[model samples]
Target: MSAGPTSFCGIELAHPIINASGTFDAIAARRAFGDAVVERFPFSAYVSKTITPAPRAGNPPPRLWEEPAAMVNSIGLPNKGAEGFLSTDLPALADLPVPLIVSVMATSAEEFSGLVEAVSARDEVAAIELNVSCPNVHSGLIVGEQPSETEALLEALRPLTAKPLIVKLTPNVAAPASVAAGAEAGGADAVSLINTLKARPMFAGKPWLGAGSGGLSGPAVRAVALQQVSDVAAAVSIPIAGMGGVESGSHARDLLDVGAEVVAVGTASFRDPLAAERILIELRGLDPVAASSATSEL
Candidate 1:
């Protein structure tokens, strides 16, 4: 069996498998592997690394700590700012075979509005994802952690553009569903979870990462991803792009069974750049519904 076409947020997708934000660097892969990476693009829709209003130096060294089936990262969303991305990276990414979804983060609604407006202006950008894990500069509250903040942010930015707005929910919250509901209520087209679990790895009784603590990812968070995805699905009527430690077709199937409209391959891509393709193939074998329901719809 072969994976059939699907749609997310009115955007046509070749398959339900897409890469999580910052996981697969399409440009880097193309530079390293040449056109082969582009010819066989792993994801149906490519999500760029999180871009901020200004350039970020990112965290210090010792940013990654590998556990048994997971890894902790304090990469700190390194990027060349929104203007740099629009000027330099956007041109290159526009050439990709798949649709591009730009992920943006900011500490305030004004900054977020600027990002959304700028990114959405580009014809090549198919959607915009809001990375809301950071603290708001005004209230000092993590927007994604609080339902009201999430809703208010979305409400402020909803009318900026007609493009789909996906709120990337943080898993640190006790009731992520409420936040998802808030996003949906405030005009989010969709919601994605779980971002990462807070972790402070230790080595020799000392903190391992330079940032002291980081977000945990990989197989260890699969169950948590499932639970949160299910919870958010029940709370919001919009679509979901579920991701955590998806490494196989069975894992993808598990997410779909729980309520994810699409599954994102993250840690698995670290091991194999073409992991999404394999997972899609395996997923076709496991779930015939994915193939039978090929019609495109929002």
Candidate 2:
């Protein structure tokens, strides 16, 4: 156990500070910081990068572009397929000092089910986070964009395993609360937000990212995240993992005030791999009891 330990979706976490799915790469960190980093890992829970049904080569060059207050990335969710992930990445992540949440994305409900079943079988994975950014083959709308679609997807995968399923919400939606309601009705253990907003930039008569459009993250999306987190919290009673431009404890406090049960450190980790520890210290300084209590219940 660690200081200010709490629970999320029945999993005991050392603290409320966890990494967003694709933000902090623990394997890379270990290579850079060695055993010391793993000995005092920053996050109470570790979320692995998103995995897909099939291997992805990723987008071409110019994958990441720095902006004024944030960054735009068109990395294209590149990763080894499910089998490769289970064989390679899973073993490497199992030894981390915190519960692990595996993130996955697919193009269809059946594909999503396959991913859910496969990842849930692993003992190291405490939960599964659906990166609902992939487009649905039938509706053509992104899974996270349509409330009905989200519910239907959840209904299909709910029985696949008993492991907790978390739906990662997209901020680029008209009614995030409604979608959250759907997830609750379909049996989601928790919900996280907001997956970067769609962004497109031009320079020298050319688009910035090779993929033409990218997702913008960092401080620029903090306000949007707060509004969305509050809306979803009001709509659903399940645990909420909130994040967006969380650079300090005050920023994280805002998310909790708006009803986020756990706060995930994302973009800021790019600048400081140990940013979560600093944020947690600051968050405790504000109201240690309140911060600990948020994730302590349910």
Clashes in each model (backbone N, CA, C under 3 Å)? 0, 0
> For each candidate, what TM-score against the reference?
0.96, 0.95
Q: Write the per-residue lDDT of candidate 2 for residues 204-280, one digit (tens) a residue.
A: 99998898989999999999999999999999999999999999988988998899888999999999888898998
> What tens digits encode model 1's per-residue C-alpha lDDT throughout 2-69?
35677888999888889999888888988999998877787889999999999999999789999999
Query: Which stretch of 10 consecutive residues in model 1 shows the poorest summed lDDT?
Result: 289-298
lDDT per prediction?
Answer: 0.91, 0.89
> When superposed on Cα atoms, how far off is each prediction in RMSD?
2.7, 3.2
Model 2: residues with Cα > 4 Å off, grouped in runs: 1-3, 288-298
